[model samples]
Target: MNQIELKSLLADRSPETPAGRIVRTLSERGSMSAAQLARLTGLAKSTVSTALSELKRSNMVVETGSESAGSVGRPATTLTLNPEAGTCIGILIGQSEIQVIVADVSHQILSDATAVIEPDYSPARGVEVVRELIDAAYANQWRSPDALLGVGIAVGGPVSPITGEVMRGGIPNWAGVNLHEMFGPMFDAPIFADNESNCSAIAEMTWGAAQGFEDFVLYTLDLGVGGAIVSGGRVLRGIAGGAGEFGHVVIDPDGPLCRCGNRGCLEVYASFREPLAAAERHVGHALRIADVVRLALDGDETCRRLIRQAGEAGGRGLGLIGSVFNPALVVVSGRLASAGALLMDPLAESFERFSLVKGRDMPDFARTLLRPSAFVDNGACMGAVGLVLRHHGQPLNLPH
Candidate 1:
């Protein structure tokens, strides 16, 4: 099949056709055997076999390798979308950086690049930097931009689900900016956009910690506190595109003001921003969150204490979330999550302390499982790629 046809199949929500089902499954799950594909797509073995043959002939799918299924018979050959078919781009517009990733239909990353910019950079500057990075991505790679199927943007702030406008309360300079209009003219492919946390949740569901759970919550603790709610296998973007903005949840009416112009919001207390600053003061030098994590992991008592305190504060907010949704799983994400057990142990302890449903009161099967994100630095960007592959959030039309 051609690029347009492949895009159509991947974008099709209906799974009535075997080709569409197989394509969607492969796009979401990467490579898998025929049996696994059948199980995932809920198609009969015979039907899958027939469809595989047709797909192979059309070059829509290709054999990747073989995996020993621990059976007495021969190994099962893994199948994936043809890498030569088309590519997709995932971009991250962060507070001080822009990242771009290029991947093929088979989920193979062709290129990854990032450019650091000043905080509060303009959208025009972001576009220029992104264009440069995209050029560099394709400069040495065999893949050409002509084969791009779609573009997915992971914005640091909330984006209006309908208008693709970056909303207030995150990324101050980007607020009320039209992302679709800003980035649309740069490419011919369809553009998709979502908040970084939501994109991170998509990445988790597709390939990371929340792989099997359809209903769960993602709590991000870094320079900012944000989250995403996944219920029934879909990320919940509330009516105003503010569903999983857990950080902005008002905790105390008379508390300290937050960047979002609210008093006593969860982020003001839980986010690692203050902690990072405190750690810098203690060390008498500038330090990124990762640096603090490294020092903590290296047995720096002060750094460790700072992280632990941040975790405890974060857990209080998480406890509130648990009280409301009571989700089966909570994936701890963001840069702080890279601290591993140092961050998790205390966070879990505090969660148990503040949550209404104590773990000690419930059976093991009924307890919520909290796990750290699988990705350290790339989850949101990768999730942006997932947006294009899964066609999760499409941009609205605006006058060019």
Candidate 2:
């Protein structure tokens, strides 16, 4: 019952020990019964019970509640991490937007805020905006910044995992910008950073459609087409943290010039930019991505056609992914995903046509599963929170 010993045991971030696995499991799943923990952690029941006893004695874990099935005579008590122990922050450094989400050790979001910035905002300006957002979030919530345990940032583009520097391709203004250097001065706690698409993947895995799947790909169709790849429960960050950058892949060497300075990158065609612009022209005014999606869902053929085309183009890139990883699941994300069947149906049809593996060629269990994301507006933000919950760090923070 040595509480200090238990804390010390759980404090180690290295994933080598049983205690580390247990701690990570608790962080990922807010609350669970001893049996559930044993099942989730794949640890022996006796081992889990022993660990729980130590954790509870140290005040690191607390008995939150109990669950009872209708036919069950006994209630199963639930245990959760001590909410008073710590807190975490998830920040999204997006294109023309910024978001901040605060949550406690128990993985419960306490407050969320967003700020919209003009395109090509300076790195210094971003730091200032993030600082103000964090301050405001804390001030409004009456939460002490001292309680913050870690911070996870979801950047709009490719990030250098080793140096925490933003790559030039995703966010032009953020080129050579070091994430840790940019935000480290604002907080004493650790920071985690990753690209927005990867963050979105993390969110999907933690709480959305990919919750139970260890391997999946997140294909985003929005103003920009981007994605992340997950293999064996780990995000496959290539040598330069560019492993899952599906959008930047040059599909046509002679095609239109892409923002990434590449010829015929998948993003140029697959991205919703052209369709969104078309929608604006048709509507005779500026329109948000969501606005177009709503119009399509409401039975506007023009809008519907626009989305369907985007889905078709997106599937071409997705098909290439199918040839490469042949992932077991694909989570279609971003604002366009909100269109649901209107988007997915055509997208799936196109995927089946273009992909090397066809549904008819594979059994039900082997066919790639495609699902829409749960959160449309705040997916990256939630993934930012996922970084805290899952301990997946970008360059800003060191991972254990």
Query: In order, what lDDT does every prediction score?
Result: 0.90, 0.83
Q: Which stretches of candidate 1 lie over 4 Å from their true place?
A: 395-400
What would the per-residue lDDT of candidate 2 be over residues 69-146, giving only the tens digit for each residue? Answer: 348568888888887777789998887888999998777788898999988889899889988988888888766887
Worst lDDT run of 10 residues, candidate 2, spans 1-10
Error of 2 at 381 (Å): 1.9
Instruction: Quote the positional error of residue 20 for candidate 1 in Å.
Output: 0.7
TM-score of 2: 0.93
lDDT of 1 by residue, 1-400 (tens): 6778788887676767998899988998899999999998899999999999999999999999999989698999999999999888999998888999999989999999999999978889999999999999989688888988889999988788888888864675788899888998898888888889999999999889999788999999988898999998888988667889999899998999998888999999998988898999999999999999999999999999999999999999999999999999999999999999999999999999999999889999999999999877889999999988887854454232
RMSD of each: 1.9, 2.4
Off by over 4 Å in 2: 1-11, 15-18, 68-70, 393-400
Please give the lDDT score for candidate 2: 0.83
Residue 262 CA displacement from its true place in model 2, Å = 1.6
lDDT top scorer: 1
